[model samples]
Target: MNELAAQIGVEVEPDYRADESDPAQSRYVFSYTVTVHNRSTREIQLLSRYWKITQGNGKVQEVRGNGVVGKQPAIAAGHSFRYTSRAVLASPVGVMQGSYGCTDLASQEAFEVTIEPFRLATPNQVH
Candidate 1:
């Protein structure tokens, strides 16, 4: 990872939405809140997103899109942007990982901030 990528931090908190999930029908709904922190001295804008989702049943899904939650947010130095998003899986357990495409506002330099793999599981699903 480049210096710009190293300066950005990504954190995710995932929850299983039992109300929206139907286990009998093999549908599992999960909501994850992500916070992107800009640790660099320069302002940065999130340009796009890339995600990889893997299910316990050995299924994988890849998603790529512009911005997140419908907006390309510009986060100032030492600031953070947070958003909540949803994902659906056929299995009760899964993992989600991705990267954010960002650009430094001052220099227009582009980089990717890694989003480490995080668990997505129903209550007591993973031990």
Candidate 2:
């Protein structure tokens, strides 16, 4: 419910796991669940994903992949696809933003669904 673009809806929820993190080594683990909703009239298939991760120290990592969680799901109009993924950062706080490439099933037209920036922070960090 955070952002919607190109007739697609993107929601990102992040959770910080203290049990899996080691602050002394500067390793922070966060799990994020993403939901991609098809808001358009045309049916769409999620083809790929593109992400840009920024660490607290200004480090950036670009990730491009064929599909999410090893699946290319075809979402019907008004339906949605949801998946969870994990990220490891060298800092207590960071950011992630990206887009999903989708194809219109009927017309075979390709378009990008924008995902707004979301924060990855430990429980103690202030917003």
Candidate 3:
């Protein structure tokens, strides 16, 4: 875990592989597993998510939506939730970063939880 990961109380682990469907296109598919923990005493409701996805060609896409996977997770103190998502990039190298909008159930006030940027690369780009 790193500092950014610690700030969000979440850990992002990425697993990427070459896209067999289009080997010559340089496209790669990546899946990230996010584990978020509620460290506060109050229950937190994840209301929305914002993501910035960049392709190898320098094109960027921003996605904002209500919750993930069509479900809002209410996490209690010391509890955690996890979700898996996929992304496709034009090149084997790119990154994804985002934040989660969460509200304290007790206060009804919302705050953004940062989701650290994670890399997507092929075996040759590992170094």
Candidate 4:
């Protein structure tokens, strides 16, 4: 990974939305909060996002789009940007991982910040 990419940290907190899910209908809803840490010296703007979602039933879904939640945010150096999003899976358990395409505000250079795999599961669904 590039130094800028390494310095750009991505952390995720996922929760299963039991109230919004319908297991009998094969609808499992999950909400995830993502925090993007700008540890680099220059301010960066999130340009795009890519997601890989894998369900317990062995189905995979890939999503690619510009910005997150309809906003391309510019995060100052040493600052962080946080956003919450929802994902609906066909099963009670799943995993998600992806990366962000960002650009250095000063240099206009682009890089990718990786998001580590995180689990989305209902209570007691995974031990």
Best by lDDT: 1
Model 3, range 1-127, lDDT digits (tens) per residue? 3322233487888888544425487667888888998877678899999999987668898999999888899988788999998877777777889899888788787788888787776667853
Q: Write the per-residue lDDT of candidate 2 for residues 1-127, one digit (tens) a residue.
A: 2222367889999999889999999999999999988887778898899999999989999999997999999998899889999999999999999988878888887778888999999987875
lDDT of 4 by residue, 1-127 (tens): 8788899888899998889999999999999999999988889999999999999999999999999999999999999999999999999999999999999889899999889999999998744
Residue pairs in collision within model 4 = none
Measured with C-alpha atoms, the lDDT of residue 6 in candidate 4 is 91
Better of 2 and 3 by TM-score: 2
Error of 2 at 87 (Å): 0.4
Quality of model 2 by C-alpha lDDT = 0.89
Measured with C-alpha atoms, the lDDT of residue 1 in candidate 1 is 86
Q: Give one digit per residue, the lDDT tens place, for model 1 in 64-123.
A: 999999999999999999999999999999999989999999999899999999999999
CA shift of 39, model 4, Å? 0.9
Clash totals for all candidate models: 0, 0, 0, 0
Residue pair clashes in candidate 2:
none
Model 1: clashing residue pairs? none
Q: Which stretches of candidate 1 lie over 4 Å from their true place?
A: none
